[model samples]
Target: MGRPPCCDKVGVKKGPWTPEEDIILVSYIQEHGPGNWRSVPTNTGLLRCSKSCRLRWTNYLRPGIKRGNFTPHEEGMIIHLQALLGNRWAAIASYLPQRTDNDIKNYWNTHLKKRMKKFQTALDSSLVSNSSSSSQLLSKSQNDMNSTSLRSCSTYASSTENISKLLEGWMKASPKATTLKKDQEKEKPSNENTNVVGTASSQFTQTKVEEGECGVISHEELENFFSFENLNSMAWEKSSTDSTPQGSLSSLNDRFGTMTEVKERSSNRPAYCFSDKWILDEESGQVEDLMDLSLDCCSAPIF
Candidate 1:
C-alpha cells in the first residue's frame, strides 16, 4: 500500500511548521549538511514525516532562500522557462536558485497562468480588430476616404471648440480666481496708500537698474519696502482698528475702508434717553419707580 509511507503517517505532524520546529530543522541541517531525511525525524525527535522535513528545509529553512513577491525579470524568466521546460518546476527552480520548485509551481498556477490567459485574449482581440479595420479601409473608395478625412477634421474642430469653451467656463467659475478678485477689490483702498511707497521704490529700482544693467540688484531699496518701522505701523493699525475692545460694530464692519463712514453713521444716529415711571401704592402710601435710568448715544445723564 504505497510502500507504507516514509515515517509512518500515524504519528507524523501536518500543516504549517512552527518557528521552533524551523529552528530545530535548520540547526540539524547546518550540522549534518542536509540529505538522508529518513534519519532526520528519528535523530531530531521531530513529529514531521521525512518528506515534510525535507520540504521544510529546502523551501523555507534553507539559508539562502529568498522570500516575498518576485521581480519583473524573475516573472518574465519564469514564464519563458516554463514554456521551454513545460511543467518541470524543479528544472525551473534550478534556474531561479533562490526560489523553491513548490513556490514556482504555486506562483505559475495562481498568478502567471491568469496573466498569460489575459495577454492571449487581449492579443486575439487586437488582431481581430486590426484585421476588420484594415479590410474596411481596403474596400473603401478614394471618394469615401476623402469624405472620412473631411468628417474627422470637422469632428476634431468641433471637439476643440467644446474643449475651449469648457476651459473658459472652468477658469471663470474657479473659486480661487473668484476669491482673488474679491480680495483685490477689498484691498484696493488699502493698496492705494501703499502705491506712493511702491512708486518711490520702483523709481529707485529703475535708477539702480539703469546704472548697472547686468549687475545684481542692490537690495537696499527693497529692504526699505519691508522695513521694521513700516511693518510696526501696519501691525499697530490692524490691532488698534480691527482688534480693539472699544471699537464699535460699525468700525468692525468698515474695517476694509477708512473709519470716516463709521464716524459719519455714528454721528447721524439720534441720541436716546430712557426715563423711570413711578407707581403709587395708595393703601401702603409708597411710590415705586418701575424703570432703570438708561442712555444710548447721549452725552447727558438720564435720571
Candidate 2:
C-alpha cells in the first residue's frame, strides 16, 4: 500500500525555510507558545505546511537555539548517553537542555558516527594488546618460579647426598662404637648390660659426662643429622608411594589443586594449622605428621 502523506500537499510549501518564514514562525510561537502545528502556518500567514513549520521551529527557529558545530564535550556526552538510551534522540536531547532532538540526530549521523567507529577500533586494539601482555607476564612468572624451584631442589638434593656419604663413612669407622662397658665393684666383678648408640672416638667428636655411660648428642650433631634426616624421610615417603614420574607429577598437581580448593573454601578451613586435629592427604590411609612443613607452607596464605 502507498503510505499516507505526512501532511495535506495541495497548498503547502516544502523544503528549506527562508529567513522571512523563520521570523514569521518565531513570532507566532512567541505569541501563542508553540503547539497546534497544523494551524500555525494558517494563523501566522506563512506558506509552509504544518509539518515543515514544526520542524523548522523545533530544529532551527526555536528560541535559545545554539546552531553550528557540536563541542567535544557535547559529542562525548552523546556517545555515552547513546549507549544507554540508543536512538531516542528526543530523550537524549532533554538532558542537554539547549539541544533539539532533530539537530542532535543529524550531528550524530554526519559526524559523531564516523568518529565513534575509529574510537571503538582503537579501544579494541588496546584491549587486545593488554590481554596479550598480561598472558605473557603470567607465563614468564611461572617459568621463572619453576627455574628457581628446580635450582633450590637440586641444591637440597646435593646437600643431603653429601650428608648421606658422610654418615656412611662415620658408621663404617665405628663398628666397635656399640660396645658394652664393664662395671667393677670392690667386693665382686659385676656385669651390667648397657647398649650405647655410638661412641665416636677421639677423632669423632664425642664426650662422656660420667664413667661407663654415653652422653647425649651435641647440638652440632643434632642440627646436621636432623636437617638431612627429616627431609630424607619426607622425600622417601612421598616417592615410595608415588612409584613413578607420572604419579609424582600427579601428586604435585594435586597439591596445587588442594591449595586452590582450600582457598575457595575459606569458610570451611581452619584459621590456624595447630587448631586442626587432622589433615588427610588425598586418599591416604595414615594421617601425615604435623611437622611435615611442606603441606602447611603450600596450603596457607593462598588467598
Candidate 3:
C-alpha cells in the first residue's frame, strides 16, 4: 500500500518554512501553546502547511532545544543506547532531555556511528591480546610443574641407587673381613708378634674406611647449610620486634640463632652428588628443563 500524505492537499502550502512563517509559528505557539497541527496554520493565519509549522517548532523553535555539536560523552551515550534500542530515535531523544530526535538522528548518522565502530575495533584488539597472554602464562606454568616433577623423580631414583650401592659394598667387605679374621685366628699361635701388628693394621684400615664414607660434618657446618632458614627467622623476629617497641634486640637475636640451629639439625640434606648412572641424557627432557628454568627465572623476584 502507498504511504498516506503528510497533510490534506486542499488549500495548503508545502516545502521549506520561510523566516516570516517561522516568526508567525513561533509567536502563535508561544501565545496559544501547541495541540492540533491541522488547525494551527489556519487559526494562526500562516501560509505554510500545518505539518511544516509543526516541524519547524518541534525541530528548532521548541523550548529546551539544544544546538551545535554533541559532546563525546553524549555521543557515547547515544551509541550505547542506540545499540540497545536500535533506530527508535524519539525514545532515545526522550532520555536526552534537551535534544530533539531529529538532531540526535543526524549526529548519530554523521558522527556517532563512526566513533562506535572505532571503539568496538579497539575493544576487540585488546581482548585478543589479553587472551593470547593468558594462554602463554598457562602453558609456562604447566611446563614448570612438569619439570619439577621430573627433577623430584630423578633425585629420588639417584638417592635410592646410591643407598643400594653402599649397602652392597658393605655386604661384600663384611664377608671378606670375616674370612680374614678366621685366617688370622688360625695363624695367631704360630706367630704371636706378627698377629699383634696385623691386628693394629686391620683396625687402622677399618677406621679409615669409616671416616672416608661418613665425612666429618660439624654442627657449625650444618648450621651454615640452613642459612636461608636463619635469615627467614631473623626477618620474622624483626617484624615482630617492630610491632612491640619493648622487645629486646638481644633476645630476638638469641631466638633467631636458636631457631637456625634447630632447623639445621631437622632439615634433610640434599645429596652430595647425583650418581652419573641415574642421570637422563634425553634431548627432549633437557629442552623441557631449560624452558622450565627460563619461566621460573622470569617469574621470580630479583631480590
TM-score for every candidate vs. truth? Answer: 0.42, 0.41, 0.39
lDDT of 1 by residue, 209-302 (tens): 3333213212453244223333223322322342222232222233323234334333322111000000001011211110011111111111
- How far does residue 62 in candidate 2 sit from its true spot (Å)? 1.3
Q: Residue-wise lDDT of candidate 2 within 57-169, one digit each (tens)?
A: 66655434445445544554454335323465765564354567877787766555544443334434545664434334334433433443233222333433343344334
Count clashes in each candidate, considering only residues at least 3 apart in sequence or on different chains: 0, 0, 0
Q: List the residue pairs that clash in candidate 3.
A: none
User: What lDDT score belongs to each candidate, Candidate 1 first?
Assistant: 0.44, 0.42, 0.44
Off by over 4 Å in 1: 131-303
Candidate 3 local lDDT, 61-160, one digit each (tens): 6544546545433443454335333465764564454567887887766554543343334334545664434334445434533443233222333433
Worst 10 residues of 2 by lDDT: 274-283
- Deviating ranges (above 4 Å) for candidate 3: 1-3, 7-12, 121-303
The segments of candidate 2 whose C-alpha lies over 4 angstroms from its true place after superposition are 129-303
